[model samples]
Target: MKLINTEEAVGHVLCHDLTQIIKDVKKVTVFKKGHIVKEEDIPVLLSIGKDHLYIWEKQEGMLHENEAAEILYGICKGKYIRPSDVREGKIELIAKEDGLLKIDVEKLHMINSLGEMMIATRHSNFPVKKGDVLAGTRIIPLVIEKKKMDEAVKLAENKALIEIMPFKKKKAGIVTTGNEVFYGRIKDAFGPVIRKKLEEYDVEILGQKILNDDPEAISQAIRNFISEGAELIICTGGMSVDPDDTTPTAIGNVGARIVSYGAPVLPGAMFLLAYCNDEIPILGLPGCVMYAKRTIFDLVLPRIMADDKITQEDLASLGHGGLCLSCNICTFPNCGFGK
Candidate 1:
């Protein structure tokens, strides 16, 4: 930073904020840091009694905050994600379409640990809607070494640190198991909840089959759905390990690879995820989904809808923020649950 005559400050960046005070009126910042001095602002500077102002001196191998922020944004910009206009040395990444957000947590950490820069973002593996601010990148100082920005670019390795996988169009068949629903012992309360959740994505309901707690019948229904071109199959009820629960057995009997039969989450610990023919997904949901505001289903649905395969390690990581507080007014996706 250097001091120069206010008249000679034109085309230079302000080193700090300049406040203008008026008695019995208002005290406001007339000019903010990083603001480029304009030719017409000379009169205002004279009126404000700022004959000499501090300004950042452009030098070799140094970058202004706005320039550094662009590098940070380049590290994060990816498919279905766009950058907000740089403002005050900050640029935010906004989602251009509704989809699942994936982040390279390790890459993001390395850039942040470099000091003098930052990238803040929403939780990874969660659903985000169009216009949601996925991440924000900025430079901490008014000016930074060009080498620092170059290091961040290298950390990206020519790939964006964040991305959005658009949800794929899928036709799903519903398998409602349990003697209670099949035999008319109780009203099928799961259908409404299941339909509402499924419709949130690009999934079309081929149809729903209400079956008894018989593994054979359940497996047959699943096969029938797969034969009818269902890309996804959801089996509600009969997921517990009880003698009467048979959905897990039915899914396994269908020659499907079970990614996981349970998660480290409450209200949906018995949730099951499987893939048939090594492509189609088959989900076995526990009973809590019918009443609970949010469950493991909400956490994993985005990944399935986007066709992003879920591995055992992916499910295991959910344990850290898996347990929901079960608040009365549940604000899922916006809460700590499954974050």
Candidate 2:
């Protein structure tokens, strides 16, 4: 690219976008890339502080900013992920469907550290809707060395660094257990809360089972749901250490392998996660889930819906940002309850 003074750029082509900023009013691209500079545009370019402009020039071993952005997008784009139009040397990766967003943080960091380029994305392992911006790739300069962009792409190996895992399993069953709610002593509040939360996802509510604090009965209910083609089973209550709390025991008795009996998160310390035949997930949510605006349940439900298996190590890693502040105006999932 060649640089020329704005007054002498009448017949030249702009290699990059020239932005105009009117604070509190507007910030727009007055002169776009590839725009043929006309005599009438000189005063406008000067007003926007563009005393000099870069003109596009074909080079043997260099890439334009827009071209470099496509390579960066290729490094991060995966299935169910699509790219936005290249604008001002930037391209955004948008979700093709509502799903779980998985980011290779290590590879992303290494690419960003290469200098002159960057890929900014949302927190990994979180839920994202269709049309959500998963990430954006931008080149710092109007032009960059082809070798530098090649180094960025090579760091991703053969696989894309960013991915969107669409929700696979959808059939869900809820089991509410507690003597007080089972009998006429108290109303069943847990079932409603669990149901409302499940409504956020695209899943079929197989049914809700209200049972007493009997481990055998709870286990049988779980088995029944699985036999009825339940993809996910939720067991609420009976998660405490008290003698009457048998939710955890009932889940284990169902022949399901436990993933993590507890997590390092607040408002959900007694949370239990187990899998039956390594496919069907049975979650034993603690008392906090019945009332807390955001808990460990909110953190992991997206992974379960997307069929992204959560390991014990996944639960153990939530210690860093697990505490919920319980703000007056709750903006969960957006806030860091279990980030």
Best by lDDT: 2
Per-residue alpha-carbon lDDT of model 2 for 249-329, expressed as tens digits? 999999999999999999899999999999999999999997888889999999999899999999999998989999999
Would you list the clashing residue pairs of candidate 2? none
| Candidate 2 lDDT | 0.92
Per residue, candidate 1 scores C-alpha lDDT tens digits across 1-108 of: 688999998899896667788999997778887789999999998898999998977789998888889889888989999989876688999999999999999999
Q: Using TM-score as the measure, which candidate wins?
A: 2
- Using alpha carbons, what is the TM-score of model 1? 0.90
